[model samples]
Target: MGVDNNSISVSLEKLERFIAAALRRAGLPEADAATVAGLMAQADLQGSDGHGIIRLPQYIRRIRSGGINVRPDIRVVADMPGMAIVDGDNGMGHLVVSRATELAIDKARTQGAAWVGTRRSNHAGPASLYSAMPLRHDMVGIYFAVGNANHLPPWGGTDMLLSTNPISVGVPAGDEPPVVLDMATTVAAYGKVKAKAKRGEMMPEGWMIDREGRPLLDPTRSDEGFLMPIGGHKGYGLALIVGLLAGTLNGAAMGRDVVDFNKDHVTPTNTGQAMLVLNLAAFGPVGGFKEAVDRLVGDLRGSARMPGTDRIWIPGEQSHARRQRYRETGIPVSRGVAAELDQLARELEIPPLA
Candidate 1:
């Protein structure tokens, strides 16, 4: 697909290298910079525009402000046969969650299932990034995270006590793309609001509302309102449950204890996340499980659709297609985002992304 006129298309290789270079200049070790950069680029590759290179400037700011530890001693604080708790030491979220997910996958290989949780991590982009990791090993991956900033209120209240806590699940398939579902418990993630503000675009009416309960369509005025939960009170409930699992249960920050990462770049957020991996072989034959998943996926896609609907889509299919298309046509970065990245590169005295 062709990129819009207001955007620039760049190869994934260039994007990853630029991110890594900028991060390295900011203080992260070469290996850590490369690891975080690769995941950030993969977010863009999967069309997660809000969580990709758009976050580089913020991360750099935090790093420079000493809010993030460049050389964190990420280690498992508590360990059991089927579970573990990792302390990130205020490190970058990508690196923290990657270590936890790796531990989860390793344990699941022998234990049939494993749950790994992290504390003192930072924003880790989209949840699907980690959840999808287990798919390569023919294991189902489930991930949860407490958003770095609290943009959500409890049901029927104006207090920003909750966040756009997210959940992601990845199920491996035989012939079909993995069934990956990644979503915020809110109607929209705050990252999307940030993305819209950067692009100078208005948000849809339902994403948020002002303190007076009026619709908030202007992304630039996002702070004046709070994000709305999906499915009304039900989404609020889910967000709370997710926060308890990913945050409170792990002894990480939650509720009022959560730091506003966007405004308070100097304070550690103590962000929390959890990764659960289930070995398919333990449930049954891995191949059989995958085949059944493929069959169900085909059935869903071929099912009848509503009058105006052209086709039915399985979860993650669109992102899968985006990944394939991006490989061929390059990833699209809005000019606004590109300009900011260029400015950051100038400040870092590194090569520009273009």
Candidate 2:
């Protein structure tokens, strides 16, 4: 049972099982493996292919090399009425952040809002995973993270000192799908560049720039250039602020302390992440608020399009459609990614994903 060389369409169940098995083989406990696998699979279902199971090989490598703790004693180190800090003990990021998000949601249910931070965690999947966690409870979720590696520099300076530093917010609606916004401060995320390189594709001109500030379109030459920020100094400022809140405030890796997890698998990245949960009932009636959101979303989507545009879409509209399509059909995996996963399966003596 192998897939074609061009691409592979994997069922959600198969993908989740394969990932869980791989994680178990990599020494993660069964429950922990299942938790991580489910979250990563949800990421893929939501169209975040770059942050889904594609990261398994790197995570497994880090685990095997002792970069991540397999048996982590994750615990809350500081506690307050509406805020708390957790130490992940260098555990898998998905596990750490999932726990943190749950804590935030529980606290917010009672206190109206709660903020939770995690330190000594690994690279979790997409930011949307954590941000969307509160949607089931009719709460708004905000998530931020210090990226696992530095790929950009200060607005004008040449030194690479800033990561993409992503953020996500998920707001529930009455009858519409939740509005989820997930974005990096940069023009493009470094993972997209890596995905392009894996597919042997050229990047868009604006994605990166060389030291001389020349457009660099070749993804293979990413090392020779730095990722460009979205709005020059503005994006740089956003990244800096996110890093401070998610990294410095949590006593986790940031700036010069961030280790390139893709390159170095042995060092503990101590990645920092934060989640804030806001209870809708805290401000007013949850039902009224959600209905208002639904109306707002409808208004946005009903707007007329420009000359070449087809239709207008809110933040999570396309992703919700993609998730539906993937659920009905299957998640498409590029040949390169499938091959890498196959190799990883073989190395771990687990069933291959096809």
Candidate 3:
């Protein structure tokens, strides 16, 4: 590990090991701990610091409080030729969604397309992690999730009946990096606000607003405000549709029933998620499709820019660049997050992150 004034750079291997050790101490099985840790570390490697090891302490707290099932018997509760529903048994969301993604990829191989949904899961890492899973198999992946907490309300209402409700899509390219779009329907995800609070930073003006409809810039006072949607009423509509598909359709928690996992560590979140995979071979010649994608990406990148714009960026381009850069220089963790991890290490009686 390398330490600078404001942050620490730790190797991906060491970070994953530290996360796994903490989870194992929290009563997770060795294999499951390792699996979840890998995904969490990958989130940081891809520049999603909010969903990475920064969340390990919270996960450990939930496990110790008996809010999450460490030995959950995650299994398929409903099945069909092209679709399936999984019961997470209140397990960690990372493990549940990993299993669902694997199932979707397998089914898509034979069925051309497959949809898999999960209920009773817990908070996972970045949406892009699962959305990018099928890329290795030459498949397009789409994902949706009902957030663990409700932070938004209906378009002109103040009730807080909706969550961020994220969505992600991944498409493969021949020579260029894969296209992965992962984002919350809100202007910013709640995790970003929590991360800002952890860093003792203030949020931007448009991300949220107070009950009085004034801009809320203080992340520490996040509970007093609500997140703004992407396109006003339209984003709220998207969030509602996403919640219905990922939560209600799968018989999971949504709307008023969604628990605020941040405040209550003793309750099962019952988070819901869905994954859809489409095999490229099923559409047309895979090689031809990839070539076309490459050409399109090249055209987009080569397009003219405005006076101040540097260049056009494809979806997932920055994350792909970060993944490559982090592999060489290690992932960066802020000093605040490092201190929290250190505290967690002491509490768990485990070695601190190097």
How does each model score on lDDT?
0.95, 0.92, 0.95
Task: For residues 168-232, write the lDDT of model 2, one tens digit per residue.
Answer: 99999988999999999999888888878877889988999999999999998999989999888
Backbone-clash count (model 3): 0
| Residue 175 in model 3: lDDT | 93
Q: How high is the lDDT of residue 352 in model 1? A: 92
Q: List the residue pairs that clash in candidate 3.
A: none
lDDT of 1 at 173: 95
1 or 2, which is superior by TM-score?
Answer: 1
Better of 2 and 3 by lDDT: 3
Ranking by TM-score: 3, 1, 2
Q: What TM-score does candidate 1 get on C-alpha atoms?
A: 0.99
Better of 1 and 2 by lDDT: 1
> Per-residue lDDT tens digits of candidate 3, residues 42-127?
99999999899989989988999999999999999999989999999999999999999999999999999999999999899889
Q: Estimate each model's TM-score.
A: 0.99, 0.98, 0.99
